[model samples]
Target: MKLPLSRRARSAPLPGIVGAARLDIRTKNLLKRLRPGDIAIINHLDLDRVSAEALVEAGVVAVVNAAPSISGRYPNLGPSILVEAGIPLVDQVGMEVFARVAEGDTVRLDGGVLYRGEEPIAAGVVQTAESVARATQEARAGLSTQLEAFAANTMEYLRRDRNLWLDGVGFPDLATDLEGRHVLIVVRGYQYREDLQALRPYIREYRPVLIGVDGGADALLEARYRPDIILGDMDSVSDMALRSGAELIVHTDREGRAPGAERLERLGLRAQVVVAAGTSEDVAMLLADAKGAQLIVAVGVPQSLEEFLDRRRSGMASTFLTRLRVGAKLVDAKGVSRLYHPPRPQVWPSVLLVVAGLVAFCAAVAATPGGSGLLESVSAVWNDLLDWIRDVVT
Candidate 1:
């Protein structure tokens, strides 16, 4: 007796990849639950580079997106990163996949189709490197539109937060002193890990007041350094990092509603609230500048136009204005790492000093009786050692 087509499909050599499915509409929340080799199912649209990097780091074997990964919205960087990492990406598989597939369900990905047992649960377009590139090229044509949107967003942010920017309003005073001190603000963003590694020497020399914005606190702890202050909405940061003795400053909305404050209260911890309209990164810089920081070094903060837009939020306008507010004192971590190399001690000068000391000792000995004979014996021993070295080299 012949089996049904579905059974036959399942029996016919299982050609593609299989993994446990992990799904969430919120990509950041999903990332926390994702295990290595799990099939990541997300609803993220126009995936940003940071999220893509997080997914890659999570070691997902494949990705199934419910929404378009690239909607041709100004060259989002996530798809390209996933494609380059050799992970299989199935795009726009629709939201019904969430109901069809449960978390931890074993699923098989064959070309663009997702399978459970023998039944094809969802099907979508398979994204390749070539496809991602083409989509990115097409998206570039939309940059002008994005730029106009960005400008409008900037004006909106300015109108809403002019008092905070101009008068330093809504900034909470911190116990961690920033007066005339070099302050290092770390954010968990692009190349943050590498930038942190590069800033080790500067960090050691200056011993700047270390401030970690959200997950950046964990980054500092991972590098074996405790944060002096932790500032952000407190969403992405670990509980251990919060209890790591850093003074906490929660960034709240303009109405003074701090989401992080509730979480801190749950943990039996207290935090000062700063009611601000911008992103935590921008607020962190503003805090440093307002507190009279002599120099502010930024690590893992977005530095390019593409990165600024990649944030996909209007808050980037505040970053622009914040930089202008503190541009003189602000320095990128990359620049500091590249240009601020500490002077190494010269071996030649020490060698010359030792040689001069030896000469002086020999002259003093020569004034004494039998000094010439002793000097001749030492010279002979040195000549013999040189001969031995030369013979070994030959």
Candidate 2:
């Protein structure tokens, strides 16, 4: 007897990629709940590289976006990364999918279509490498528009926060000393792990004041280094990192509304608040400069134009202004790691000195009357010990 479609789906082997559906509008928040072999359903548009990298790290089997992953917003890096990682991407499934699909529901993705048991719930265009490449190429034409928008945003930011750039206003006083010291600002951006590993020798020698921005604190902890100061919104940071005894400085807006402080309060911890009109990265740099740091080294901070744009227009503008404010003192980690080669101690000289001392002793001993016979007896004993060791091994 033939069974119903739902019964058949239950009894028989279900076709296509099957996993639990994890849904969230916010990509960063969604990342925390995602697990291996789970299908991620997100509403992110024009997904950036950082988010893509995090999603890839989460080991999600497939990504089903409620909106377009690439909306021709100057070739955003996310879709290509997902395609390269071999994770199945289904784009523009519409917002209805969120309502139709429940969290932790068993779902099946066959090509572009999403199925719940025997019923098809949603569908989208399955993104491939070729399709993503075409979209990226098309998106390049939109760069001029994005640049114009970025310029406008920069002007607006400069006008609103002229005091911040001109004078170090709203920078919170910190317990961690920064005067006449080398401050290392770490951001969890491109090549952060690699750059941190490369800077180990410099870190050990200089013992720079380490400042971690948000998730960068976790990065420092993972690299087995304790952060001197932890800065940022505190959304991405772990609970353990918050309780790590590092000085916490919450980045706030000009009005002094600190959302991060609330999180810390919930955790039964206190934090100093810094009101600034830029990103946490920029604020961290400005704070270091304001605190009289002699030299500032930036690790995992975005260097390239594409990287800057990937963050957003406002962020790019803030980064530019902040760099100008802290000029001559700022250095990239890549340059330092490449150029700074520490002097290594020579081992051959020490070995040679020990050999010379032994030879001198032997020569003095040989000058004595019965020294030659004594040396011969010592050599014989050494040979006997070697033979005995060899025999035991055999």
Summed backbone clashes in each candidate are 0, 0
Which tens-of-lDDT digit does each residue in 86-198 have in candidate 2?
A: 99999999999999999999999999999998799999999999999999999999989988988888898899878777788767778888999999999988889999999
Tell me the tens digit of each residue's lDDT in model 1 across 182-284: 9999998989999999998888899999999999999999999999999998988999999999999998887876556778989999888887887999999
User: Per-residue lDDT for 270 in model 2?
Assistant: 86
The best candidate in terms of TM-score? 2
Q: How close is each model in CA RMSD to the real structure?
A: 3.4, 3.0
Each model's lDDT comes to 0.91, 0.91
Which residue runs of candidate 2 sit more than 4 Å off their true CA positions? 1-12, 255-258, 363-377, 383-394
Runs off by more than 4 Å, candidate 1: 1-12, 255-259, 365-394
